[model samples]
Target: MSLQDKNIAMLYYGEQPHPAHTGFADAIGADFICCNPRSDGSKIDSPLNEFFNGFSLPDYDIYITEGSRPLYSGIAATIFSDSNLIYLGGDHRLRELSLGGFPNQAQTDTRYLRTRSKILQFLCQHFIDGAIAVSADSATFLQQLFGSPSTVRTAKPYVQRDVFKSLSTLSTDLESKKVAVIASANRGNVGDYKGIDMLVDSWPDVRNHFPDLKLEIVGKGHQAKHENTEGVRVKGYVEDLDTVFESIGLYVQPSRLEVFGVSVIESMVAGVPPLVTETTGASSELKGIEPALVVDPNPESIASGIVQYFDRTVAERENIAKECREYAMSFSPDVRTKIFHEEFKSLIDEIQ
Candidate 1:
């Protein structure tokens, strides 16, 4: 179908410089629009605002909705107004909203019933066909909120090709003192869920094991305190992550829970070994890959995993790196886009 004839409009917070969000928009053949609140002097209001102000979608069948918090509010309103199907992607935070003062069974029932009534009203008004959530956890949350499990479908998170290409050139030299990277964010922020504090608390033990090991910390908010440690460096908010990935020997993601560990996949594609938590979404995909080390969030496990990599022979390390890179290629954006296209088409047909 032609872009106009397809009748799809993707409502997201805004296009990040990161490839995944923009890449998904390109793949869907939909009119992508930002619903984020415009901040004074912020560049976020530049091109997207200009485009959305003048743009209109005449014939889109779906609205691929993404983003967190207030942006979600705007997208929800749009969905209600349009009577269209919405595919919820990214982190699903709606399940966390509190239904205040609903203590008694009667009050609780009334609260939930009211919420569902509004949702159903919106769905009927907008002609919502269905919704596909990126994670099973997210789908479960939606089902709980809506009291209709049939309305929500679950899908695994996919990697974008551009991110793969960016990661593809990363060096896999284990002998080098290339530190694994973690970007800290504000508490209760998106990155907070990434478990930066877990890594921070483990830093001292990690440093004691490998004195020469360096940590490349990026992004803003509470910087990790490595006061007595020499190797830990905070490189705040780097724009060129490709360069950072190139110099890094490994990427570490110590999250307690993750819907999809895109960073791990990116690290594998970059030929950098990933030391990740077993609880992460990427762990399932990295099963049998030698370079991708799955470890507990504890400092001892993280240190041991690093030591094992260092202890390996150059040839063995290279072999592991090759395996990682090969594994990462299977999740490339093009492959994922095709899968999404086919799955979405099938869902549409099934509903029709």
Candidate 2:
């Protein structure tokens, strides 16, 4: 059969479908299935019960879903053991990310989390036919830790370029010392995960060098704790980032464990140079342009990076911003969707 003739479906289990899944489905002419909870008061007690929620597995030559929990993609792999099951791997084991802090917490139970990783790893080694990860680090983890036998490839996640791109011309004059850190704290206290507190602690040191430097914290539930922090503005939840990016001189993603920092690319596309952690997936993007911008996940390193960026002459900073914007164009959803289609087609061709 021709690649175009294969039946492909993206199986997702959540309240809302991820843009990456939907974009790939559209690009490759696949069906997008949402395996969300039913209104029949069904509780997801196990992987089997997760499927009991009113949705039948649609017939398809290939099935794709996010790889992580056994409850999310495990049931599909189990049922389609003989077919081509591709998992988009992006998750990591909790212990590999950080010591006990914030979401990881001192008292958080590890039994369930560890069990889920084990089960997912088992599925990857036995049942999964192909895997694509959001970053090279994640691709390595999927092969080394998850024990996937298949060739793991790294593909960038879909990012909306037009939405986050700079609305006006990229400039160095509009407050070059102002920096913004965008992170979500909705899951729990992501302060440790995102390095928000670390960033806050670094702000004073950053201001010591550049006294006019300003920091803005943008995201849900991120402001309450840092609202009173010196020279820090907490923007709770911004509806329109177009305006926010307009004023942002520099972008920082201090995440200790980020599979792929989408916001970093978004800010870069908006003509803002970013200071990201060395381990963050998006750091790869910045390292190629300016290696000095990628810092270690610590207050001292973050503070030093911020100072170095602001110390650059305005013309040099403007050049960096331009380069960042141009490089970020390669990571857009349109570009990534095509890469996904080509990768999926190769997998389909192999099975045929």
Candidate 3:
């Protein structure tokens, strides 16, 4: 029943493999394969369908992939026919667990997305031997969706602490006056999910309290909405996040729905304190480190948290920054691989 001697493979349909997938592959010593299921890479069909369209799946004792399934009309049971399928469910958002059976704003926004969400709901309720969630909040959501608490396991994404962490002591002047939000601001799904508009709306109030405060909006897509916003700078997709983190005093992820905010973790690793929304999957990490930093998802609440952070003495803020770095260090790639190897062994044995 143990995976110690089993053949495992992690299949991801893209040019790049997710860091979490790569970490899991290392944990179980699985073959990590980057597969392009569709030549054109359109989202019309599930990756599973496209994967079968052009690629021949090799047999392995265990098969791992992101939690994706063919649509109701698409091919369903042909792929991974004889192997144990484990879903990496950490990367996607299921509705907020607290909103159980209730329609939230995100749920009601898009008919297309709602249909897709229903399909995933059915998959979790009926299929898959196990689901791996990266954060405790996500694990709880999967446990509910899987309807079997034991089938859900918690693991973390691999963070490149070496590249993301602080290269030197953080500067007080730089960090104290600046805050960065790194999610994409593309209109519709990308913009709405990240609550970029809300963050921008809140920036003026925060600046009103501290006139020198500046908000840096990073990531790509049309950011014209932020162009005239006072004291806000839009840096579209910088190649150097380490440099970005080094320059900021605070990081904020005002996400309406994020499975796990990777940038939030990156900022923590770089010795910058992060203020995240309660719904953010990474808030599970922040709550344990500093409860006050996890604010409600709204302009007023987010602005309040930012104001509170800037309210702290420089020495007090620096102390929190140090704690953030220390806490995030536990999730570095090497440490997580070792932890996940043991955890996955237990989880697989239980699943068998």
Instruction: Give a tens-digit lDDT track for model 3, residues 1-352.
Output: 6676798877665455666667668778888644444446554355545535523455677777654431111122224365666777655535543343322354444666666667666776665677778778788878877778988788777676455444334443435587888876334335467778888899889988999988888888746668588988887778767768877889999987777888888888778889999878899888877899999889999999999999888788888888887888777778888877877777788777
Q: RMSD in Å for candidate 3, one decimal?
A: 4.2
Whole-model lDDT, model 3: 0.72
TM-score of 2: 0.83
Q: What C-alpha lDDT do the candidate models reach, one value each?
A: 0.59, 0.70, 0.72
lDDT of 2 by residue, 1-352 (tens): 4557877777766554566666767887877665555456464555656545423555666777754443344355346445577776655443253233333235466776567667656755666666777887677666764454355667778566456444324443435567888876545555456778889989889988978888998887674767576899887678777767778778899977777888888888778788998768788888889999999888899999988888788788888988988887777777888898777676556544
Of models 1 and 3, which has the larger lDDT?
3
Best prediction by lDDT: 3
Lowest lDDT 10-residue stretch of candidate 1: 96-105
Candidate 3 positional error at 45, Å: 4.9
Where does model 1 exceed 4 Å of error? 1-4, 14-18, 38-60, 68-82, 92-163, 184-190, 220-230, 290-292, 298-300
Clashes of each: 9, 0, 1
Pick the winner on TM-score between candidates 1 and 2. Answer: 2
Give the range of the ten consecutive residues with the poorest summed lDDT in model 3: 69-78
